[model samples]
Target chain A: MIIPYLELAISFLRVSLSAYGGGIAAISLIRHEVVVIRGWLSVEEFIRVVTLAEMTPGPLIVNTATFIGFRLAGVPGSLVATTAVLSPALLLLTALMLAARRLESRGQFRVRIQDAVKPAVLALMLMAIISFGRNAVTNLSTALIAALALAVLLVSRRKVHPVLVVIAGGIAGLFLL
Target chain B: MFVVFFRTGLLTFGGGYSILPVLHYELVDSRRWLSEQNYTDIVSKATAIPGAVSVNTAFLCGRVLRGKKGSATAVLGMAIPSVTTMILIAAYLFEYVHHPGVQRFMKGAAAAVAAQITYGVWLYARSAVRSVWVVLATAPLFAGAFFLGLHPLLLVATALVVGGPFVYRKAKLKAATSSPESEYSELME
Candidate 1:
């Protein structure tokens, strides 16, 4: 049991470190690892975890970790998995902060790094959009709602808050879906 | 104040776009901590980082509002609700979310989320993809990832290695063009 718990922690650590475009991107990877590779969870179990993670709070990645941990090893496992997943990020953030002042002082290096990073980041976003979109948009009503939402967003120039859009969409979904 | 944002964070489903409107209302319209321009700037910066833009925005906003104490408060607020909820759900209804009705609703919500994501991509492209060169570069990059089944991280890594030199040269050119004389002139003005 302890060994299984340790494996779960390490597996979550790998997922955390590899997740590039944040939580949504991480979900696919987590699903693949836990459901497909490790056999720790089934596909249905994976989706349930994801749904719970989405409906809950904090980072989705952390929520997923907690859920997976609890599922495998109870309360203690949840704590271990969450800590393991966050540790890498905490350490990386600390290292970055320590070097931040020095890095900022070097304008050329800073600009170069930004230049390299920006496009890559954009690419990641594009990937996330495409992948998640395929999974999310399935039916006609949904497709239309998504189209309406997109139009509202584009035309409004982000004048509206995303929360309202989500609420409106939810309400629309309740009626339309 | 922190608790308010925390609750908002927990309530937010979907992603950054889903939460953006609420955040704008709370931070700008209601709280009046910063102007619209400031909020937009922070969002841009948050997008550049490798995390949830909402979480990053919360951290930045908190820090701006109250320094380290504010930052701590903000993160705690944002984290607590979701952490608690997920844990409870994990413990109890671990098997309950998969009902057909629930899945149907999630599917519907996901569609709305898809649109939101598209809007985000369009918005970011408008600001970031200025030149034909950028478009030319971005289009095929997206196509390769989407169609070729290429992993996104690998694509990002490849882009960094390949685009680094040209981007470096461009930065150097821009820096050279904006000389010390202009910098001093602007400073004096």
Candidate 2:
């Protein structure tokens, strides 16, 4: 039991380190690793974990890690996995924050960092959209709803929130699906 | 303060994009600690770093508002609620989640989540894709990941290799043309 818990902690650490651009981007990688690579859980189980992570609070990565860990090795495993997934990011964040403060005093350094990061962030977001879209929009109803949601998001001036958009989609899904 | 932000983090659903309007309202419109421009700028920075945007936002906001202590409080607050909730749900999901109504609700929620994610991608693109180069780079980069099934890290690394030099050169040229004197002074300072 202890060995499995340790293994779960190490696996989650790897997943967290490799996952970029946060929860949504990490979802696929976690799914691949836990379900496909490690066989700790099946794909359906992975999806269920994702659903739970989304529905619950906190960041999705940590929530997912905890869920997977608990399933594999109970409560203690959950604690270990969650800590392992989070510690590296937190440490790196502290370092980066310190560096950013130092660099902010220098205009050229700040500008250079901004210039390099902007388009790269954009590219990463685009990748997230495509990857997630392929998986989520498997039918005509979902596709149409997604398109309408995009249009509403881009063009609407009512300041209609994304949550409301999601709610609307949910309503549409209930009626249509 | 930690409890406040932590509750906010846990309640937020759909993902980063979904949380933005809320964060805007809470921090800028309501709390007034963060300005609109500042919030947007921080969002960009959070996107660049590899983690959940909400957590990153919490950390930055906490640090800016109240320093290291504030940062710790905010991070813990934001993380705890969700962690607790997921654990509780995981414990009982197998027995309780199989109801037909619940399943139906989940299906609807999943579709909505997809839409929310798409909306976020579009919004980010609006800010990030100001130039022709960004427009040109986005599609193929996405294709390389989605169609080719290349890992996202590799795509990021490739984009850095291929696009980094050009962007750096452009920024340098802009600085050179705009105000070389000020740039040099600032660098020296």
Candidate 3:
């Protein structure tokens, strides 16, 4: 069990490098790792955690990793998972911080690199919405819940917090779902 | 500085790229701790880093505010809430989340979240779908992902190989024509 856990941690670390392209795009990669390959989480649980990450007050990837970690191996699991995702990133960031002052022409490269990633990010987002949408919108009740939530979000102009909207969806589920 | 990022972390629901406005308000508008250019530079560079974009942003902001310790402090402040919240959920709600009543809750929550994700993707599209070719290009990518279940890295690699040269050439053009001042100005708005 421990060995498998370590392997899982290593996999998480590997995934950290590919965590670029702004995060929503990374969701497809994460979903693939969690649900498709590892089978650590079912689609429903993964979706729940993604929403829960939104309700929590941190980065989505960090929250999702921590939550999934906790669900898998308890506190230690969460720690390992979070550390796996964060440590590589933090190290790389620290090195860049030290080096950035000397490096000229970073801004142009940054723009081009981001631009190069854009189409892929767009495609990944498409994959995430279609695949996750299929799993999430399993029935009419769920469909209505989604439509209502989208409407509420649209109507509110995003002034209403997403947490409130999600919690409200839970309440709506009590009767409707 | 730690207190600032701590507060930002607590306020950062839906974190990824969402923390930018909050950070901007705190650092540039409210406290004036950093200038507008400082904020823009931090954000653009941060997203390019390998970590969670928010964490990278927070860490760099902290580093800018103080030094190495500041970066560590900022990241710690940002992460504490997430770690604690997840632990509590694991210890308590893990079981109940799957209960019949809560399963219904989960269903609804999932739907709402999925809808929210759809809205987010649209926003990303507005920025990313620069040309009609991008739209045409996605069909094969979609089929690969949906039907063949190819890994995201493969698709991403494909996108890089296919789309990179055009954008890179455009960047060269901009570098030739425009001042560095104008490049970041687009982001300021």
Best by lDDT: 3
For candidate 3, write residues B1-189 as lDDT tens digits: 778778777765556655655576567756888876566556645655666877888888888888888889989988887788778876776655556786676667667767666655554465456688778777787688778977666876787788778877776687668876886774342
Q: Could you give candidate 1's per-residue lDDT for residues B36-135 as a string of tens digits?
A: 6556545544544544556666766776678668866776676667667777987787667766666556666667677766665655565566577666
Q: After superposition, how far is residue B76 of candidate 1 from its true place, in Å?
A: 3.2
What would the per-residue lDDT of candidate 2 be over residues B49-155, giving only the tens digit for each residue? 66666677677778767889987887788778776777788787556666666655556656666666665555445555668876677677666765787665676
**After superposition, which runs of candidate 3 have C-alpha atoms over 4 Å from their true positions?**
A1-11, A14-77, A90-111, B1-78, B137-139, B179-189
| TM-score per candidate, chains pooled | 0.80, 0.80, 0.67
Question: Each prediction's interface RMSD?
Answer: 3.3, 3.0, 4.6
Cα lDDT, all candidates: 0.67, 0.69, 0.71
Candidates 1 and 3 compared: the better one by lDDT is 3
- As for lDDT, the candidate ahead, 2 or 3, is 3
Worst 10 residues of 2 chain A by lDDT: A107-116
DockQ of 1: 0.48
Computed on C-alpha atoms, the DockQ of candidate 2 is 0.48
Clashing pairs in 1: A57-B82, A161-B21, A162-B21
